[model samples]
Target: MKKPLNAPVLIVGGGIAGLALGIALRRAGRDVELVELNSAWNVYGVGIILQANALRALRQIGLADACIAAGFPYAVSLHHEENGQPQAARHKPSLLDEGLPASCGILRPALHNLLRDAALAAGVQVRLGITVADIRDESDAAQVSFTDGSQGRYSVVVGADGIRSHVRTLRFPEAMPPRFTGQGCWRFTLPRSAEVSSAVMYHGRQARLAGLVPVSPDQMYLLLLSEEPGNPRMPDAELPDLLRDRLQHFGGQIPAAMAHMPGPEGIVYRPLETQLVAAPWHRGRVVLAGDAAHATTPHMAQGASMALEDAVVLADSLDDADSLESALQSYSLRRFDRCRRVVEASVQIGQWQMRPEPGADPLALVREVAVELMRPA
Candidate 1:
């Protein structure tokens, strides 16, 4: 096949990773097109916590200020258990003072809007309601065939698709698969007036975790996590009672917050799965990003942060390599090690959180230490 006259770079999946990649390529002066499978954006979850490292990645992409503004400065996380009083604390010098941005939390949809707006501002062509049917590379250029029957090519194709990435499966079937962590989460938006003042995580015997995060004066984000996969179909009439039952002992803001949990219609439940692809991230003009490459569990709340990191690094690796093949090699070199470490660490942490009984406290301690050491020095 012949390359188009003005073939723009193609990006599959317009979630955080894909959109970020489009933005990065645009900044690098590349004509880019991003195709999203969802008819529109789908970020209707709880708040996302951005660690200092995530902020640094946004800084590289120059979207830090806007993203930070769209989110509340969640400097500290308050953790408690059924019998323990909540403990409020901030990151120590080991991480925060290391130059990473203090952890900040943002409503999922709000952050999506921020990234989408910035992409438009950067001149990225974003197409929603579009699914990719196929992708190919020829004549040193990549081609993406969409379910919409349209075809386009570029010198590079970045698959920022998520864990269920069609691009990754179609292109690289042997790639590492998403591993179930035996964990799941349910997210909902509760009225802030209900009583959650800040971010809080309440731990339980089976490591059942419930949380609330205030995104604004009137709204708060609530998420409930369980040690095993869950499919609790909470009804409208039972939503509040259900949450109250799970979070009753979580002092401070949680109890009151659960009292106003959204009705069944507004509740969203999703499972937790992590992926590990420690191999090359690309094939000639094609490459992977975001969950397509590393779908991490939320144990340390670093999945999204890692995706942002992937976006920046993928873009940085393609600086004037001799060929598209060469550029892909560079992308893998820059990303595999960092991503592998994160994947391994997240798995360990998640396992620690979900482990049964007397083992919980000791596991949490180990996780805490590992997290501190992983932060940039």
Candidate 2:
């Protein structure tokens, strides 16, 4: 992939996808500038699981070692009864075959810090507390206006803003809004224990899904998924009691973890929602990627992974293709169906969990998706 001359690229949003793309492009000796709407550059949530496929993408940009150093690595996903008795353990399929763990769990901020440092080190100019106010695409270049009353011309403009993307609203006015998936997730961080080695999930007899994910050698986090009929809002003050009450059906390490709730700072609750942009992700020199293109539920744990994959693929496309149009088209063609499958499959899993039948096998659905994800995205 040869670098293009005078290809000043403007990327909106400095989250996972945006930052990763900045690193990739800069490492390839491309001129790129990234803008993030958040001035503080804060990242919410506790921990995230990086599946093998996500790790592969990160490896492409030479950040896998840093990620592993900052997170906990595990090769298995264990299912347990409410009493903490082991029910079944499914080992994730290894694609790299280089003796690396199949998946990893890391604190969200830790991952963010790593990516930010790498992006800065690669010479990618990052501007915070700014956003794109306007975008006009022409035959060979894109003119972008900033909220700070600044303008620039670039070979390409990427919208990695997120699900509630301003670029999506401005570029694709007819795009459908993200839909609620009738589910909400509750998370709490806790100290890691000797007994917790892998991602262990407890299946409550009353149809609740809760899990303890090890994020590091001495830290871990708990995640609970329950049905939310109307996508109700949850207040921060009530999150502790609500989470404790919901964990009553489970009897294992969950009780002990619940006992150590550290006020509102330790708890995070969010309603599950998803969105999938139709094909033709690019309009002339402006393109969309990551959550702006496809957002999914935590059921399949592929959201961040998808974003990382998008960054690597997009950078590669830009380098390999002959022209800006060719590069954006190649990036879209490579990512569309792969992302659609993940979004649809993740939503399907959430739906099945919402309405579990007497003989329904949720594990089968999970295994099917996991197997497919083991393949290159």
Give me the candidate number with maximum TM-score. 2
lDDT digits (tens) for residues 50-95 of candidate 1? 7667777777788877776777655556677655575544442224
lDDT of 2 by residue, 136-250 (tens): 8766678889999998888888899999999999998888999999889999788997888999999875447999999999999999998878888788898898888888888
lDDT comparing candidate 1 with the true structure: 0.70
Clashing pairs in 2: none
The ten-residue window of minimal lDDT in model 1 covers 89-98
Query: Which candidate tops lDDT?
Result: 2
lDDT of 2 at 35: 94
The residue-level lDDT of candidate 2 at 63 comes to 92
Off by over 4 Å in 1: 1-6, 87-100, 193-198, 229-245, 357-377
Any runs in candidate 2 off by more than 4 Å, and if so which?
1-5
